[model samples]
Target: MTPRLFAALPVPEIFHKEIRRLQKGVPGARWRPSANFHITLRFFGTMDGKQAEDLDAELASIAMPPFDLTLQGSGWFGKLDPHSLWLGLRPSEPLAELNAKCERAARRAGLEADSRKFHPHMTLAYLQGTPIEKLTRFAERTGGFVTEPWRATHFTLYSSQLSRGERNIYEPEADYPLL
Candidate 1:
């Protein structure tokens, strides 16, 4: 079976301790392990081997300088019925440009255009029937959350599969450096 693939910048470990502190206070929220934390650039879905190869080549061709990104605030996806909690990122033009490059690579690799607009955030947890009030409170309490700016020097192509317990296991397939 083809693997579900995506391009993302892995969260640096230095900030994991602080990030972990905010993982609590929300009941019934399936917290994501720190190891899985990443700011996704583009999700390419399941791709056959040939398409994967083409994508790898296209992604490797991306040329951009490293940029600094800062984590800021917190939010959830669903307004009426909250689905997931996420940590937001401060606006950065370099980040957006990199995302656009990843999108172009996916298209050049024969993947369909992504319909969802790009929003840069690292998912903190997945919510299931989570109370809207609790989600709101979590958002409010963590509104001032911010991290020291981190340098993103490279992006990775990852293949993810559902392991036991339905948790995603992301394995880095390739690393593309920004030089």
Candidate 2:
């Protein structure tokens, strides 16, 4: 079977402790493990070996200088249902350009255009039937969260595997430097 894949910049390990501190206080929230923290550039979905190879070749063609990124604020995706919680990032033009480049690579590899708008963030947790008030309180408490700027040196292609009764496993397939 083909692997589900995505391209993303992994969150630097320096900030994991602080991020972990904010993962609590929301009942029934499936908090993401620190190992899973990343800002996705593109979700490629499931791909055959040929498609994956084409995508890797296309991605390797990307060229850009490294840029700084800062974590800021916190929020949820679904307002009414509150499906997921995330930590936002300070806006950066370089990030947008890299995302666009990834999109172009995907198309060059014969993948369909991604319809979802690019919103740079690191997902904190998955929510299920979480009360709005609890989500609000969690937001209010961590709303002003911010982190020191960190350099993004490279982006990676990762294969995701579903593990029953456990967090999804993400394995890095390849790395593309931003030099």
Candidate 3:
């Protein structure tokens, strides 16, 4: 069976509480379980058995040193369908390099390249009819947010499915450790 796949950096649990603390006051905001938090490296859409193996090999070939990452600040995007709130990440050259590598890996695996630029952030919630004012206030409340630097040593391949509650469930398919 073909499975939808994505490559991402896992958010360490030490920052989970801070992320959950901001999940208030936004009506119609579908807050995600902290379990779903991650900084996506690249989305590979759906891949068949052979394609998945090829992508796995391409990812395994990627060699990069582990780097420190910090989750800081917060914001939201869109008023239409893709409306969502997110916690921002401090930009890192190493992260960008890894993301570019993931993109190239997707291409080598016979998948179409992602057309959008990589913007790293941990998604906090999906909004349906969240008030604009509440979104602004939530942003202001989280403005001073910062987390201690943590070592990012690996990335993972995840597969997701829609659950009974209409929530998306994510499961780790594979882990690719970094140098």
**Which stretch of 10 consecutive residues in model 2 shows the poorest summed lDDT?**
160-169
Per-residue C-alpha lDDT of model 1 across residues 26-85, encoded as one tens digit per residue: 988999999899999999999788999999999999999999999999999988888899
Tens digits of per-residue lDDT for model 3, 16-95 = 99789988888888999989999999988876788999999999999999999999898888854448999989989999
Clashes of each: 0, 0, 0
Candidate 2, lDDT over the whole model: 0.96
Candidate 2 root-mean-square deviation in Å: 0.8
Error at 161, model 1, angstroms? 0.5
Q: How far is candidate 1 from the true structure (C-alpha RMSD, Å)?
A: 0.7
Per residue, candidate 2 scores C-alpha lDDT tens digits across 1-179 of 45699999999999999999999999989999999999999999998889989999999999999999999999999989889999999999999999999999999999999999999999999999999999999999999999999999999999998888767899999999999
TM-score of each: 0.98, 0.98, 0.95
Pairing residues by index, what is the TM-score of model 1? 0.98
- Over 4 Å off, model 2: none
